[model samples]
Target: MSVRDPNPLDSRHPKRVAIVLSSPAISTTTGWPVGFWWSELTHPWLAFRERGYEVVLYSPAGGRCEADSLSDPRDPSRYSDTDLISLGFLSTPKLAALVEATRPVSELSVDGFDAIVVAGGQAPMFTFEKATELQRLFVAFFEAGKVAAALCHGVALLRYARLSSGEALVKGRTVTGFANIEEDFADQAVWEMGALTRGTHLMPWRIEDEMRALGANYVQAGLWRDFAVRDGNLITGQQNFSGAATARLVIEALGG
Candidate 1:
């Protein structure tokens, strides 16, 4: 219910963070291309970087990862047109290279990083729930008393990850992710796009629905607000707009 190990992590020369991202995938409900969200990844990365934390981008299978087109600042949709952070990140070759070819999440170990943050996007709704390997890695960090965090639908991993005692990591804990209100809006947007879809539900599962099913005390701010809750070392953001706020919580927990 609070910081697991509050001792400052600054003893190390600039902390290291392992940010796991969802790789490319197709949406089952809408038959649209899906990947990580640009703002979710960039905002958090900047928060950590500005704190002098070394961050590494990793994918489940390793290789180039793509961002959901609508989340892209350069997209014609203008959904994220004002996202200068992602625009700056993508335009700069060196910083952009981070997500270009990510190392495999399987190669990661708690020994190499101070914290882990799973970014969310369209792909996560389809890929993260059944990602046992990602669940294991995330649980590893948490069990080791390290800072473990996730944003948006990426928090889906918590629904299945269990502690050594076989209890769900989120059981009876306080958390937040993409809320049902936000999901409803997303569903409407997809329907408005006239995608060849059978239903208005744009996702296989909703983050709020799943987390609540797991018995977590799911809390949230207004839709699209910068809300993040830190139940000890496990931190979660409300939605894409909450990325930097979530990362700041991690930074706070780490005493960065």
Candidate 2:
């Protein structure tokens, strides 16, 4: 899916950005379906498109991408009503169609895009945590000096992603991701729904723990607040709230 610049006479080639999302996956702990977060994708998408960048959506396992129900503003739980940006994006049928179907990352050439932004959700904990291909793609973007970013659980990929130098991508770099306190709150919310009564942790490990173990200079804002960090071309956001901030940083890195 592509978004053309509003100006018809503009002949210059627009910047290209790729947004990688997770394919639908069932949460082992909750026994509920999970996928990409709505705000995490939509907010950054808006930021990129408004700057006249052509964005494409891709998935590790291509095809239709589902949004985590809790992140849907229309969900009965009303947990994300304040996500007006996603709501607005979802309201546009043509624009929303871009996420409904996605190409596989394997089909996308790294050199075709200037940057890549990995979207976050519960599924990333399961799908992206060990995705070697995604790890390679992200590392390529970083090594090429392009803007490479991952937010929230999407940052889980960095735990095992290695650079050509055989070091973890986040090693010795400042980064942020879903925090332990944030995970605690999420687990509490899930437990309230009886998903934890079956004796399973929402995620195998917290992103903060994994990054810190890899010697990353991990940082975070207060629980649930917007926070993002940029260490050279590597950009990361603390949680869903930081999506736009992360996208803006990418734009800055691209000199947009």
Candidate 3:
């Protein structure tokens, strides 16, 4: 894919995008190390790059980010063998380097990009939740009229990201994230593996429950389906599978 130049005068300048990922964190409930989902990052990246958009990877804490092992297609556990998109992305040394050393969110200038995409995994439940800097950065991009997108657990960041007016960013907008049914399936899978108790939760709160409580019109498709919703400049995907769809929406929003 050809990278777009950022200069507006150049005619060939491509729109710029910032993809924020969570730094490595251990799931307190399941005691598993997690960061970003491989497909959540790679699929959207492929979509954006294919459209000739320039993308940069970022993290709240910077440095290398870990991928949730279950999201890895080559993982011996075979949970994601069908994820050929992520597999192809992982095999590309140049493209794979983007996740290995990410710039911290603090170093990014919101005005420099046309859009922002936040990728989620098990770690967002711990790291992205209540992240003031991330909240501000997302709000800045949103308030600037830039396309702001999030998928799966990454949407949890919207729970506390308030506008300068002190209102929740998702208050009246439509959005979607990892659904309750999907989470239940994941929990059951963990339980079957003896990694969690039957009644224990992988996350403290459900994304749907929280989004509803905040007054956002939270929508979901069938469990594990590739669902994405766009409300003007804000776009959200239902789960890891919806990444590319979500990215395409962002591209369309940017007038690509």
**Residue 82 of model 2, lDDT score:** 86
Assess the local accuracy of residue 66 in candidate 3 as a C-alpha lDDT between 0 and 100.
Answer: 93
User: What overall lDDT goes with each candidate model?
Assistant: 0.88, 0.89, 0.89
- The count of backbone overlaps in candidate 1 is 1
- Residue 84 C-alpha lDDT in model 1: 97
Candidate 3: tens digits of C-alpha lDDT, residues 1-256: 9888552232388889999999999878777788899999989988888777888999999999999999999999998999999999989999788888999999989989999999999889898765778899999999998988999999989988899999999998999999999989988988898888789988878999999999999999988899899999999999999998898788779887
Scored by lDDT, model 2 comes in at: 0.89
Residue-level lDDT of model 1, residues 70-90, one tens digit each, is: 888999989999999999999
Cα error, residue 40 of model 1, in Å, equals 1.0
Single out the weakest 10-residue window by summed lDDT for candidate 3: 4-13
Ranking by lDDT: 3, 2, 1
TM-score of 1: 0.93
Q: Compare the candidates by lDDT and give the number of the best one.
A: 3
Better of 1 and 2 by lDDT: 2
| lDDT (tens digit, per residue) of candidate 2 on 1-256 | 9997444323288889999999899987677888999999999999988888899999998888999998999889999988899999899999789887899998877899999999999999888765778888999999999889999988988887899999888889999999999988888877788867644678878899989999999999989998899999999999999998899898888877
lDDT of 1 at 74: 94
